[model samples]
Target chain A: MAIDFKQDILAPVAADFAAMDKFINEGISSKVALVMSVSKHVVEAGGKRMRPIMCLLAAQACGENDLTQTQRLAAVIEMLHTATLVHDDVVDESNLRRGRPTANATWNNQTAVLVGDFLIARSFDLLVDLNNMTLLKEFSTGTCEIAEGEVLQLQAQHQPDTTEETYLSIIHGKTSRLFQLATEGAAILVGKPEYRQALQQYAGHFGNAFQIIDDILDYTSDAETLGKNIGDDLMEGKPTLPLISALSKTSGTDHEIIRKSIATGGLTELDDVIRIVQNSGALDYCRLRAQQETQLAIDALAILPESIARQGLYNLAMLALDRIQ
Target chain B: MAIDFKQDILAPVAADFAAMDKFINEGISSKVALVMSVSKHVVEAGGKRMRPIMCLLAAQACGENDLTQTQRLAAVIEMLHTATLVHDDVVDESNLRRGRPTANATWNNQTAVLVGDFLIARSFDLLVDLNNMTLLKEFSTGTCEIAEGEVLQLQAQHQPDTTEETYLSIIHGKTSRLFQLATEGAAILVGKPEYRQALQQYAGHFGNAFQIIDDILDYTSDAETLGKNIGDDLMEGKPTLPLISALSKTSGTDHEIIRKSIATGGLTELDDVIRIVQNSGALDYCRLRAQQETQLAIDALAILPESIARQGLYNLAMLALDRIQ
Candidate 1:
């Protein structure tokens, strides 16, 4: 499904996406070459490029196929997303990302941080160039929500009694906000308010499912496919949905072991923790919940006219659920 | 002169400025209380509150007396400036600020960074509330420039070959951009375009003088008065204007010691390094240059009508220069 969607939908826009990459690379000036280099390094390192592609595809779906604004906005969203990742690596203290050393690990924390600031600044500069006040305001608000989400996550970390509502709020702030903004910004730029709202709802639910699956994958996927070591979230003491839900369901020794591991934030005996989660049916439960969200995300698109882009988005949501299992 | 100015002008607005503080404190929401608390702790630690005051005075100096927008813009500038300080503390890894434990040292780098981000986000949110796109664009651009400047400074650190032009650019980026923005934003809000340009010039030149004196003070001032250790810049290997000028002028053994000390970034033999800078006449040269810039700043205010606020601005610029000495 993923292969077919990528070949048919993402292929035509691949060159435009490449052009957006080139635009960002050229955007960082020579005066801050070091920061630009570090920023470019992290950006150029392969990711799914899912957010930018969604942005461009959303624009295409809206029928305002002006590739200029579409491409620029695509680059802007991607850069903003990448900036958050660079800072996240520092906050998480994770050494590896996307199968390679994180920028913070490669360069010291200081450089990583300043470079993150540079990318964020660059994102704003690009947005300002678009001269759309509404778009600027929305993007700026999105950035703020993203920051608040990160702070929420920081507050949530290592706390065993975190509630599901709080967990959802954190995911909404951290993941869904940007996804919603990416599609919504595209729709706004193309003057499709109804479609923009629909796309926003689509992206928001899709993002929630995507992040849940990501957290679940941390438990079920091994080091190779997951890029970094498995149980990293546990090591970081991130009480993700699966673990939180699993903890709520379990009792006695199972609960105590999970609580102790979260408190210590060390996974020397990873197999034991994984066994508890799997045996408790938390992984299956998480997959089921993710599937539900994916369905809702697809449902949000019911108002929009059916197009290849809309289908691709639906496939993307399904792919997120499928990848987790 | 400083005593009289502070007693008369600053003391009166001290009440109005105190109101601005309430606005800032109220701006942080309960949802992100932890992050906001950390931000407020640093902001309220009793730095002079000079920047916001400058914003208020600049607006008043233009002969417009609606204090509402001026007060809000002042708070916005102060929040933006405070955010940079929080991030700067993380970048510098400094432990003490304003006679208290630095936020980064007390809370941890993650909190410092995210809290700083929160403040920045809040600054924009406030700007959006003002519904002035001109101020928002100007302020946002100023922020991006400030980040770029800091990135340049990070790269320039430990490099002895940094030019005077580069040094000026860095200081302008780090200090003057926001200084200019504070005054200019106020003027724009108050509907005084001519005064806005003049105030921007005044603030820009004043900021340069202020920063130059600050660097000089880092070399010559005592720890008790400065609230920071002398040679803190040297320890950080920051090639401030004084050090850069001294490096260019000195030759033979003195030049080698200065270069090596900057390269290594320490004050193990403090007296010796001070002696090199003193013998090179770098400290005196920097003071003379700062005085010249302060005069230039005062001169830039010539277009404004003769008013107490204008006099207050003049007094503040003089106070900045005198405080360094």
Candidate 2:
């Protein structure tokens, strides 16, 4: 059966989701005009509010009904996501994301960078208001890893020697660590210390699955379907899973072509690279890896009680996988 | 009484400063090679470690000689300062700072941006370990103001008619807020709540004086003296105090020239603008304002007890004022 985002995945936490969504606006209401406008644009432009929903769902799955702190955590999660997106646009020099113009595109890099800093600081400010040192430490350390992951990606750019292990490290830091923070932080806030490891594992595997699916889409999906042009990673010389796997699968000229394509990023060798990546079974390997991660994520959820919220989280993971299928 | 930095300012808390400096290295120690290298280069390139010194001195002035927690706070202040400088170099597109290559110049903007992020997160992570929620809230809110001040500076850039009041607000955010954080945070960390107001006032006024002197030197000091080119602010069309004061002091062509210089950023009319500013009593006005701020900063220290550390902070304020004279 097809999963609906609102009815299936977000149903158990729908009220909490709506409340958390309002907090994002309150979190971003700044005295500075440019901050308010730019933050509004980027936060409003955010797609589906996925990460915050994950935070809310995870909170409920832990059987903590008090939605007050959980809602704030959800909002903080979104603010952190928005901050990274602002900086990512500046780093990528991107004009648009998911159909809307990015913060950097709308207000230049200087404004975007500073506002991103503001969002990060404000998120911490709100987190401090929660009066939980453990949660603050978790988020602060999580953010550092997220940033390191991004730099590691930059460090690996145009380098063909990057291993799958390095790629996993990159994806985990840039992508999964925040997911871990969202779920694990909720458990921390709820005082369910026992659930911390399980939630972190669930979010970790889920984030890996999500990112792998994204990497897969970079090679397989069309612009209309993905809201991003295919070969976008290639243009940036991002040695994502497909290119990395393709290089590993091929040999001689095919290997050299893949290596060259990863090293000198552009779409000049677009057709040949795509053909080689597809014909060489690189996509198949990626799909298999993604499926394994999804299974691990689903298994991690078993540690939580069988509740509607747990089912919602499971559905969310499955829905992310459905995008590829 | 010509002030010597080591004797007059750093002497009282020199040992704590040394210990705190170690924390900076420890804090920035990451497995990511690029993060470590870029962070080390920028931290090594730091100027005087003034902020951390203020934190240590403030802790000492509060009569809390327990250097354990204070040392960590001082290091956190410096890490935060270094983080801002890294991003500031990117924002200004500056290749050099303090006669050394900037992080953006040494690495790339992407690396600098991400590493700056890592520093911010690391600083917060360390702050969380201090386990003081009040201190955490102060810093979290303080950083938000800092970022806003930066954005306000960007928003006011290239636009003339920026009022002196607006310029003061800008300086307060960009310069004074962090200074306030450095000293005020020390008091909070040391459990001297009453001294928070006094230390905050001293640091705030001192920061204003410091920034005013720095801005004055932007027009008056040469690359040889200040390691920065004269008219650097004008090149960016920054409506700093000298420009703001010059506009108020002039009329007719002289006024129009200052306005045009600010409106259209460049050095075409740099000499004329500088001549008009110096000859129009703008420099004297700025110098007078700097002196007044320095006096105010010193007066704020009366609430604190007579201590060697307080004397050092007082001497540091005076030395900053001496830069203009």
Candidate 3:
């Protein structure tokens, strides 16, 4: 299914992403070649390119067929997304990302930080060139929301009793805001308000599901597949939804182990923690919640006319959930 | 003179700065009150509020009659400046800033970084509200330039033979860009096209003078007056202009002492290093060069009609140089 989605929907958008790479590389100054080199390294180290692809696909799906603006918007979203990741790696102090050393790890923290700032500045430059105030305002607001979400997450770190409402808000800020904006921005460019709203709803739900799956995979997937160490979220002391949900449900021995693991933020007794979570049915619980989100995302797309892009988006949502388990 | 500038130009701007503080504080969600509180603590710690005050004063001097816009621009620039400092403290691993514990020191690195991100986002939010495209573009470009400067400085750290050109470029990025933008942005806002170019020129010269003085003060000033420990830059292996110039002139025994001292980057024998710098005439050379730049800044203001604000700016430039020695 992943291969099919990649072939049918993401292939054309991949070309757009390539064009973006060209644009950014061209923008690099000779004096700051180190910044450009490090930025390119992190950017070219492959992610799914899901956000840009969604943007391109959503624009196409809306039946406004000018590929140039869509492609630029796609690149802009991806660049913004990459900038956030660079900053996130610093904030998380993560040594690796996507099976490679992070920019911060390879180059010092200062380089990583400044390059992140450069990328953000470059993104805004590209955004202004797009010449759409409404789109610019939306994207800028989305960027702020993402930052706020990150701050909220930082504040919530290591606190075991973080409520579900807080968790949802954080995820919305950190994950869903950008995802929704990507689609919504594309729709705005395409000049379809109704479709833009529908795409935003679709992307928001999909993003929530995507984050849930990401948290679940943190526990279930090994380092090789996930491109990061298993239980990294635990080690980082991020009180993700699954653990919090399980803590609320279980008590006594189960609750104590989960609580201590989160507080200490290590895998000292990995098997024991895994056993507690498995026994508590936390994984299943998370998967059920993700599935529900995926369904809602699919429902959001029902308002749009049936098309390959819509189907591709639906498949992507399902893939987000299925990839975890 | 410094005290008077602080009282007149800076004090009024301080009131506006207070309003800006209130604006940002109100924007933060109650959910992350702790993070906001910590962020506010770091921001409110007594620093001269130099950048924002420059923005306000420059705007007023450019014949911008509206105090409110000038104040808003001042607050925005300062917020951006504060954001950079917060991130910089983390990158530099410094424990103190403005005679208080740094955000990174008080909290962890993650909180410092995220809060920096939050502040930057808030700055953008403020910029968007200002609805000035040219100002936004210049400010965004300034951010990129500043980050580039930081990266340049980071690359130059601990490199014994760092060139004068590289040193100048580094300072231009690290300090001059903000000053250039603050003053130039003010001029731009006031619709003073003729003075705008000169204001930027003045800012450029003044910023160079300001940073050179800062470097000189790192050697000459006590901790109380400087709000940072003398030799802090040396301990951090920052190859500032005075040291570079001193290195260029000296050879044999004195050169070796300077080299070894810089290589070690601590004040085990700080007094001895200070003696070598003083004896080498490096301090005098830097002081002379800074004074020249201040003169150039004053000359740049020749086109502007004389007013209290212009006199204040000229006095501020001279005061910056005087404060160093």
Candidate 4:
């Protein structure tokens, strides 16, 4: 049976999710009109809000009652996520995100950059209000790693020599680190130290699996299917996992094409590159890796008490895998 | 009295300033080569390190004996200031800062933006290590206002209707708030609650005066003297204090010219705008405002006991006013 995201994953924290959404709107409130409008635009453009949902579920799985502070944490997680996306759009020079005009697109790079800075500052301000030293440290360190990951990705751009280890480091920083912060932060807030490691492990593997699947789709899916154009990564010469794996498996002309495509990012030989990636068993290896990661993510949740929220956490991991399947 | 910066302002805290400079280099260390290099570049491009100097002096004036953690706080203040400058360069598309190529110019906007982000996160990470909730709250809130102030300035760009009130609000966020954080944060960290208000008042008014002087220089000074071009603000159509005051004090073509120049940023009417700004008594009004702010800054230091550090703060304010005199 196919899993339904709304029924199996978000259902456990539906009310809290609603409350968290409200808090996000409140959290981004600013006296500056442009800041408010840009923040509102990007926040409204948000999809699924999976990170905050994971935070809420982690709080519930820890068996916490009365989640007033938990809702705020959820909101902060989402705001941080939104802030990154806004900056990412400016970096990518993207005009459309989730079928809507991005903040950079609507205003300009200056507005996007400054508003993104405001969101980041506001997120920390709200986190400080939570008054947890450990949580603050975790988030502060996590954000640094996230930024390093982004710069590493930029460094790897057009360098086909980037290895899988480097790729893992990049994905871990850019994607999984925040996921760890989300669930692990909830554990810290709820005063459940024992559950922190498990949730972190769950979210870490889940984030890796999710990003790998995203990269794989860049080779396989189209703009209509994923809301992200196929070959987007290739066009940027980003040596993602599939391309890296394809380099390892292929030889001679096949390898040269992939290498050259990465060194000089564009879609000139996109069809040939995609065909090579598919034929060289690179996509198969990526699928296997994604499955393993998803399994590890689900297995990590075993330490948490059995509850609907825990089930929801398990289902969210599986749902991510379902996208590639 | 020439108010030599080296002799009067920096002498009292010169040793601690050295320690803080070392701390700044160590603080920017990163596992990622690109992040480290970009951060190092911008930090090296920094000017006289005024903000951190103010922080160190504030610590000494508060009667703090041990300067260990105070040095780290000073480093954090400088890092935060550098981070803002990095982002500002990107926002303004500036090629040089203090005659050194900017991060965006040396690398790219993507690198500059991401590295700027890394610096911000690193600053917060270091701040979290200090384990002071009140200080963290102050910085977290202050950074938000700083970003909002930047966005407000961007909104006022090409907008001639901007008032003196709005211009003050802009400068407060863009320039003075960090100054407040530098001094006020030192007071918070030193456990000198009594001095926090006085230090904040001094830094806030000093910041206002310092920025007003810088704006005045934009009309009067050139690259050879200030490392900033004349009419740079007018070139960007920024309705800064001089331009705002000129508009308030002029009429007919003189007023119309200033209004049109602000409405559309460029250097076509540069000479006319400067003449009106000078002849309309705008520079004198700006000079008077800067002096008043400087006086307020010095007056705020009266609450602190008579110490060399207090005198150093007084001299720093006086030195700023000397630029206009």
Candidate 5:
């Protein structure tokens, strides 16, 4: 069954999700015109806003009816996400994101970097206004881990020896950590400590599944798969799951080809690398792993009482798997 | 007699300043090797540790005998300073800072940007541990202004018509705001609200004077001046006070030369701009402004009772002026 993101996931918190945009606009508002314009460009360029939507859904699932504070929290989540994406575009030297010209491409790297910084500081400023000590601590610590995860991924680049454990840690930091913060933070803000662990677990596994699906798409060349550029990961020598799995399954020439591609980080052998990755059943292993993570994510929700919001959260994880399917 | 920084300023906070390094080392300690190394490189390359020293002196002047928390605060100030410098190098695209290879040059822009982010996040994580809401709010707000200031400077670049008022605004954000946070944050941490305004005023004015002197030195080449390369600002079309003042003082070819130099941002007319700026009484006006700001900074310290720490703060501002003298 095809899951409609609007009907299945975002529907539960559509009103609050829309309300979150005001706080986002307010958050990015600055006295400096350049800061405002560059920030507005990047924040608007944000894709789907999955993290904040998850936050809104998690707040609803926590049995909290008043979502005024949660809406602000969702805005902070989106701002932080936007900030990272802005820097990511600078780091990747990427010109286009979601079919829109990136901040780095449109303005310049210098403007993009400073405006990204403004968004981060502004996010923290808004987060402080919530005045919740526990929430602040969680976010502060979570941000550090998120940055470390990004650096870890950079460190792992071109290193074919990067183990699966290392890969998991990287994804956990870069992808899962923020997701954990989004849901767990809502639970924290709403004074629902009881739900913190369960929501964090659900979001963590779900984030892993989401990223794995993303990594799978980088190699999956379906003409219908909108933005997924085939062999993008291989071209960067990013030893994502497919390459990591292929490393273990192949031997001799196949292994050497994979190793050289990762180390050199180019597209000269993209076809052979993709063929070996497919032939070695690495993609199958990756799909199985994604399925397991999605199931674990869904299982984590058993602790929460049945609600439309919980079902929405479950649907988000399932929708991620649908990408792979 | 030339002021000895060690005896005149650092002498008061020497032991505490040395102890602060322990906290700095701990703050940069990350599980990720790349984050740790990049952070360590930048933090270690820090010059004179002026900001943290000012913070310790401010804490002492606030009559806080217990230096434990203050030391950690000083470390946070340094980390924040280091993070900004790392990003600044990336923005400026300069290969060297204080004659040391920048993080962007040492690793890559990607590593520098992400690790700079780690330093920022880690600084906030340490700050949240202080459990002082007032201090957190001050820092969160101050960092936003700093980023805005940086963007404002970028906006002002190649703009020959940048007014002195706009120049002050740029310097305040790029330089003084953090200085305000450092001293003001110390006061906030130590429960010295009464001293907060005075310290903030002192640091803010001191930051202005310090940056003005730096801008003056950008055009002042005595050959013995270590890192102050003449016309560096003009080369980048950075309309510092000298150029802003020159615009007010000159006419005809000299005026057009300055305007064109700023508008174009290169070294072709560098000699003409420098000759006009030096001959046009613009540097004189900038020197007067720096002196006025230094006096204001020192006067702000009058609210604090006479103490060696206060004297140290005074001397730090004085030493900044000694460069111009």
Candidate 6:
């Protein structure tokens, strides 16, 4: 049976999720018209809001009943996610996200860039209001690493020499670190110190699995299927896991072609590159890795109390994995 | 007598200034090579270190002799300033700042944007270590307003009907708000709540005076005199104070010309716009406004016990005015 996200995952925390969603709306309110409009556009364009939901689930799983602060934390997580997405669109020069025109596309880069900055600052502003020093420190440090991760990805662009270890580091920073913050932050907020490690572990592995799947889809899926063009990463010469693994498993002309594609980003050789990635067993290895990561994520949740919320987090991870299957 | 910045303003807090300068250098150190290089390049290209020096002087004026935390706060001010400058360069698509190549020019827009983000996160990370909720709230709120101000400026761009009140709001967000944070933050950190209002008032007015004079010089000063090109504001179609005032004080073809110049940014009618602004007495009115703001700034320092540090703040305001004289 397939996992139904609304029924199995979000059901237990549906009320909290709604409240958290409202907080996000109220939190991004600004006096500037453009800032407000662009923020609303991007936030509404946001897909699933998985991170904030994970935060809400993690809080409930910890057996903490009081949730006034938890809701705000959830909103902060989503705002930070939205802020990065806005900047990412500018960095990628992308015109669409989730089939909607991106902030950069609808408005100019100047407006997107400045409004993105506003969102980031506003996220921090809301986090400060939660009045938890531990949470603040974690977020501050986590956000710095997130930026570093983004820069590292840029530094690695087109370099075929980037190893899996380096790839893990990048994904951990860019994607998983925020996941860690969301779950671990919730645990800290709920006064459940013992659950911090378990939740961090769960979020870290789950985030790694999620990004690996995204990278795989980048090579395998097209605009009609995923709302993201196939070969988008290759177009940027990003040595994502698929290409990295493909480079290791093949040699001769095929390896050289993959390397050239990575070094010089564009789509002229995209068909050949995709064929090579598929034939070279790179996608298989990526699938195995994603599965292993998903299992570890679910296993970590065992440390949390056996509540509907923990099961919700578990179901959410499995549902993410079901995407590729 | 002309005020010497080194002798009159910096001398009182010279030792603290040097220490604060070192802190800025230490603060920007990052493991990522690109982040480190871009941050160092921008910091080395920094002009006068005026904001951080103001931070030091403000701390001293509050009768707080222990200089440890104050130096860090000073560094934070400079870091925040550099972050905005980095993003500003990207938004403006400029190659130079203070006669040096900007981060975007030296690297790329993508690199500049990401590094700017890293600097902002690092600043907040360091701020969290200080463990002061009130100070954190002030900065968090101040940064949000600062971003809104920048967006407001963008919104006002190429807009001819921008009001003086709106322009003040813009400058308050873009320029003076940070100055308020630099000084007012010092008061908050030093356990001097009594000094907060007066220091905030001084910095706010001083920043207003500073920006008005800069705008005045755009019409009145040449590249050789101020290292800023005449009619550069017109080139960007920035509805700054001179053009806004000119709009208020003119009509007929002159008023229409100013309005058109603002509505469509470029240097096509640079000379005519300059002449009209000068002949219409817009620059004179701007100068008078600058002087009034400067006087109000100096008057705010009367609440502080007269110390050389207070005098340094006063002299800093005077030196800014000296540029026009």
Standalone chain B TM-score for every prediction: 0.96, 0.99, 0.93, 0.99, 0.98, 0.98
Tens-place lDDT digits, model 1, residues B1-325:
3446567458646666877977787656547667767876887775878888888888888887777778888888888888889888999998889889988998899988887777777777777777776777787677778988898898889888888888888999899999998888888888888787789889989999999989988878899988998989999888898788888778988788878877888888567778877878888888888999899999999999998888888888988877766
lDDT score, candidate 6, position B308: 90
User: What clash count goes with each model?
Assistant: 0, 0, 0, 0, 0, 0
Residue B189, candidate 1: C-alpha displacement in angstroms: 2.3
Interface RMSD of each: 1.8, 0.6, 1.9, 0.5, 0.6, 0.5
Per residue, candidate 3 scores C-alpha lDDT tens digits across B1-325 of: 2447666556534555566555545444335675577668766873777887788778778876676776667777777788889888988898988778988899888778777777777777777777778887887777778888888888888777888789889989989899998899988877787788889889999999999999999988899988888998888777887788778778897788778777767777678778878888899889898999999999998898887677768877877877865
Looking at candidate 2 chain A, the ten consecutive residues that score lowest on lDDT are A14-23
TM-score for all models, in order of appearance: 0.96, 0.99, 0.94, 0.99, 0.98, 0.99
User: lDDT score, residue B315, model 2?
Assistant: 95
What is candidate 3's lDDT per residue for A179-228, written digit by digit as tens?
Answer: 99889998888788879878988999899899988888887888777888
Assess each model's interface with DockQ, reporting 2 decimals per model. Answer: 0.60, 0.88, 0.57, 0.93, 0.91, 0.88
Model 6 lDDT at residue B202: 99
Q: Write the per-residue lDDT of candidate 5 for residues B1-325, one digit (tens) a residue.
A: 7779999899988999999989999999999988888998999899999999999999999998788899999999999999999999999887878778999999999998899888889899999999999999999999999999999999999998899889999999999999999899899999999999999999999999999999988888643464535777877889999999999999988999989999999889877777898999999999999999999999999999899999999999999999899
Write candidate 6's Cα lDDT for B192-284 as tens digits.
999999999999999999999999888888887776688877888899999999999999999999999999999898999989988999989
DockQ of candidate 6 against the true complex: 0.88
Q: Which predicted model would earn the best DockQ?
A: 4
Expressed as tens digits, the lDDT of each residue in B1-325 for candidate 2 is: 7999999999988888887777999999998999999999999998898998998999999998877888999899999999999998899999999899999998888888889999999999999999999999999999999999999899999878899888988999989999999999999988999999999999999999999999999998999889888888999999999989999988999999999999999999988988998999999999999999999999999999999999999999999988988
Q: What is each candidate's fraction of native interface contacts (fnat)?
A: 0.51, 0.81, 0.60, 0.90, 0.88, 0.80
CA lDDT, candidate 4, residue B189: 98
DockQ-based ranking: 4, 5, 6, 2, 1, 3
How high is the CA lDDT of each candidate model?
0.82, 0.92, 0.80, 0.94, 0.91, 0.92
Worst 10 residues of 3 chain A by lDDT: A21-30
Clashes of 4: 0
Model 5: which residue pairs collide?
A: none
Where does candidate 1 stray beyond 4 Å?
Answer: A1-5, B3-5, B8-15
